[model samples]
Target: MKLKNIVISAVAALTLGSTLAEVGVGSKATVDAASINSTAQTYSYVGTSYLYKILKAAGITYNKFYKDNKITYRKGKPEGIVVHETADSGATAYNEAIFFNREWSNISAYVHAFVDDKQVIQMMTTKYGVWGAGAIANKRFIQVELAEVSTRAKFAKSVNNDAIYIARLLHQWNLKPNDAHYDGSGTIWSHYAVSKYLGGTDHTDPVGYFSKWGYTFSQFYQLIKYYYNLQGATTNTSSASSSSSKTSSSSKASSSSKASSSSKASSSSKTSASSSTSSNSTQAAKATVVKKTLKHNAYIYTSTGKRTKTLKRAGTTFTVTGTKTIKGRKYYHVGSNKYVVASNIDGTLRTLKHNAYVYDTVGFRKGTTVLKKGKRVRTYGGRVKIGKKYYYQTSVSTFVKAGNF
Candidate 1:
């Protein structure tokens, strides 16, 4: 019986493996699979989550990433990676991307990435479940393809790349290296392991192929864990960088770059140092204008809306009165009837202002876009009113304040 077992194992060692989520995990592509991650790669991410934005920002792209709106989006907190083998030795990673991008592939399969000796290509996103493994396995794992090469050396390189790439993904999801072996609970696994554990698929893939190079699932797990630990530590560096960026922004705020001369404290040539307290109190008592940041360097006009000797600063705030409309244009009362166009705010979005940005909220969201500073926005028409302030409807969900325009 032992000799028979040995013979069976020897015979099973020769294996080759494939998914364009429907082209399934083991199929040939019409195009060279080698070209998928090369030349122009895929950046197909579905859903409008910030994750997609971040992935794009990080330069992590997938050209073939897609979502079938027909399929009810089943969300999963991916606990681990489910590894698979594209059994075709001739099939390259690029071809998998092409296959996954379509709905007409022969096999109904899906996986996250395809790795070969030359490159690692992602075909889909961790955000969606592809029908690579059986439904059970697909529910909880991010499936990846490790392309089988003709030569052992290339196969080993591909394995190495898979380990590195999967490790990075682990770090991205804040997952640790799971020690559970196919309990359907570990952080990573082979397609065969997940199939066995979860009863997800009938096909026991990658096993025969991995055995060819004396590679074991256990070894791959350990390699990925090693890299995960390395990258998990490096992820903390981004926090340090964010802190540094805050400090830099503060420094710029305090410098002349952000604030102008008029906005500087103790720049008063109008008030004397000696007995200046009474003078300041009298000036304060007479002035009822509200303070605001200079959206740009502009002369502060007198009560007649004429330019005063005082030029408002950029980041440094000055004052404006409440809201008022004049000549069919919305304007803020900077001092008494002395008004500044609401659109001329330092960050004030003038209609068609060069580099003026519109945000997702009155207090904007991340990711800024520049607008043209061409036409002066003097429109008094507004719908969204909060307290004494008015807001223009930028979108159904977003608004820009007239006070801050």
Candidate 2:
């Protein structure tokens, strides 16, 4: 069978922050899965599964090494996530990442990331699409592959990593978690769901794999919802805090109201509250979006300063919303929990020393766009090595020889 190409840190802080907020909100995080006595119903959706509980407690460790491909979604943003299984019961996430990174073009299969018992290794940016599923599904959803594991504990850990990572991605993109329904109008999807509903491929993965452990896609969705709700809880807390502040300020003015007139004041206050909320929304629209060009090969990072993947070669441009200092190094804040070092970019201007042929990621000639000798064009930072020769990346897929510059 042809293998299917598959498809945080600020997320960690958000997880922790939400956990703390739940305490104040009178909500309790689920108990650890190990404490629950095992039963046939342990993995069912009637209640929180033992696996879900344990994953919530163990948390997730995120690692990213972006593959060279930079294909964006057809709509420029993914709508949801597709879950898959490697079917190769013995492969690890790292092993799969290595194999696919090299053979993706040859096999014509690639995914956004892979999940195993230990960590979630994201090889591609979810902001873009991969050739994992059929053309339709690839253009719409982010894809993830779960590595098959033998041991039960390892399986549990892998599922935990999978759910946590998916939940974070969903939250990052401001999307909701929904089961893949028959009408094909949901966010969370399985490869089988895509095969059956979307008609891109015939491979039925994860569904059969989940069956071996008496797990169902519905149950897995519950696990994703568990973490997704936690993220929403934290976000709600922030909104609530702002609301309370406004309420407190308003209450002070009403304190002088005569008790006889309290009824009339109640109606007035409700209208005033509505006006305040609208004003806040208008102010939020002022956030400035800043665009910058890379000066060198720069890594896109998490808010925590952990590197996710190296971006395109220097001189490539990126639009960022803001900037922040992580670990004392200033970083450009790209949306969806991504950051880039401020120093890696200055501008995107380069003068060609000689005429140069633009090559693809794998050294094949990409179309016929050639830079003329002494012509000035914007190029990105870093040298991309194709075979033994290195070239300067001029765009997401275009590269020119360093000798020509």
Candidate 3:
């Protein structure tokens, strides 16, 4: 029985050794597989109420076959990065992944990183394929999900962070601008764009969020272009020192010079344009008409469309005789009442109904002839006959009758 146990242990050790040898020391097997597996499993369902701190601290069980580890190829090369913004506020990575897997049947493209204000969570390996870029699924691309509430400030910050992250990632990947999702033939497209291409016609994502931050799709493309230009310039300079061949040196130098010049021109142009745009934006903001409110005592017409009297209390109502516009807005004139501009009214003013008197906080007096149709009408302390009997102003306050003419 002792001999049997020793033999079994030796066989097991041999099998484990062969497996380790096959995976190699430099391979991902060096990391704890269980940890990675746990992370992969939990990534499918993060939500608003999720405690990120707990998840961060928990153990991850690593699975090499997970979306973060699997890479599928259509041709030979990987695609570019796809940018996305989750429309749901306070969404968690786990929930998003679960939704994608279940409802979308994992049919959707995969994202590599989930970014919020404070941290970037890596859900998948950059080398592997994740469902990030729609019908262009087979194309290798990194998808970054930005966590942000859809407000102007948060949107701006998210855009800035996205730009910085993408720029850095492209730099690391040695990708050209043309290789970016928005630039090349197999360029990166939004979920909406992909949905349209696939003939399903129901998807929009980065577009809406990017637009909220004042970036159009084309502008986003230009940003990628800018980064690519920077990367290309760096590469050209690095390669320039390696070759002793005169022809290669000359070509490299010429190309480098042109690229440098172009970069400078582009940078200057962008700076100037940004400045002009900001200036115009500021001017526009300043030019907006601010609403101002004014409080004063005025008699409102209630009944007897022609009579007007001084109102001393809140509920006093009198007849409004006419209407006029001052400073480009309309106001009602009670009999012998001073015209007050509608723009100066504090609260929402209802349309003045004929023969209706709204009580005023202010008081108006009778026999005061205020302007009406470029003229004036004298208001006796009582109801004055106008064009109609019912169309007269009535004083809600004490009224003194006018003397006989």
Candidate 4:
């Protein structure tokens, strides 16, 4: 019986060895299979997030930076950074800086820094917090706005600059890197997160903006972590480069060049020192008159560009009493002191191919209201990419698939 058991064991071992020899454990087929799986995992983000491409593109860009002394936070120090995206799709960081610097009081919004593909313009110091997210977030977070761009490479570069900037700020504040969680526990918070958990504002930015490029906040958090974990990556504010003095010089030169550009509107010389006083006298002189229907919900602002309490719905017709330019964009005067963006009126007509649902600017369904098939509608005259699809703006906070029309 023992000899028979030994004979069976030897036969089983020989069979296993024969099977291994036939398959060849380290054969070309096995190596190829492993290589394909690894490649699949590595390039999974190719068409979507561009994370793989960004990870290999460059180390860190030496961006143009500027600093200013502004109002300090109520807590004397910021606990984290709030990420924001400029609502305007075409505005650069310098362009945004010019507008915010000129109209912070009127708009009641200001951020510490604005980042674009080409530069990082620090409008104010991180030691101070600006009225960016809301009362609560403003007091606790250093706000930074990422300007939207047109191309993939540019977007990659812009985000690289943005992540590096966030990392540097976190390093400067001695705050550890953390992704914002449901409970509002983290050193990195998005404007959307702030609105969701800390509610002083209603803007859901960066999230929608990132979706347009197939990017997500999670990927951004990963990038932030990448920079934060580097050995000497974020040791100083001038960590954009090794030479602090050179960085300062370049920043000043870049800002001065922007100021000298004629394409940029001359920022309002009149400052709003007192909220009670208005800056209408410095506003653009009235030019033309026209009447049009609002294509999207329009916010009525004072003649001095201060947003008022009024919101006009789409499909409402109004007489544009006059026209004026603010920060180089046209505004239609609807009343003695009321104004709205001129583009908000004068929409492009379309006929619905199917029943359409209205979506918000961030691609969220506004309500149950649906436009029936064959119905004629007007769009805000441009297509906005929300997620991977294009939508036509029917109103502020309302959109429908462009294909549906």
Task: Please report the candidate that would top lDDT against the real structure.
Answer: 4
Q: Lowest summed-lDDT stretch of 10 residues in model 1? A: 243-252
TM-score on alpha carbons, each prediction = 0.43, 0.44, 0.37, 0.42
Candidate 4 — which residues are off by over 4 angstroms? 1-71, 231-405
lDDT for each residue of candidate 4 in 1-405, tens digit (9 for 90 to 100): 001111111111112112212122345544443433222211101111221133235443322122332656677898899887875678887677666655565665677777787767676556676777768987798888888889766776677667756766676678898888234679898766776688776556666666555556666786677545531221111222111111110110011111111212222211111121232433545433444555444568776666775655444456555556554455666787887765555445678999999854334454589899999876663455544566776543356888998
Query: Residue-wise lDDT of candidate 3 within 12-64, one digit each (tens)?
Result: 11121132122122334323232322222111111111223434455433323
The better-scoring model by TM-score among 3 and 4 is 4
Regions more than 4 Å wrong, model 1: 1-66, 69-75, 103-106, 179-184, 234-405
State how far residue 11 of model 3 sits from its true place (Å): 58
Model 2 off-target regions past 4 Å? 1-70, 235-405
Q: Can you write out model 1's per-residue Cα lDDT over 216-250, one digit (the tens) per residue?
A: 55556765664454333210112211101111001
Cα error of candidate 3 at position 378, Å: 91
**CA shift at 308, candidate 1, in angstroms?**
74
Comparison by lDDT, 1 against 4, better one: 4
lDDT of 2 by residue, 37-109 (tens): 1211122111111222333455732222234556667777899999988877688877777677556677778
State the C-alpha lDDT per candidate.
0.44, 0.54, 0.34, 0.55
For candidate 3, the per-residue lDDT at 321 reads: 38
Lowest summed lDDT window (length 10), candidate 2: 245-254
Q: What is the C-alpha RMSD of each candidate to the true structure, in Å?
A: 19.1, 21.3, 31.2, 26.7
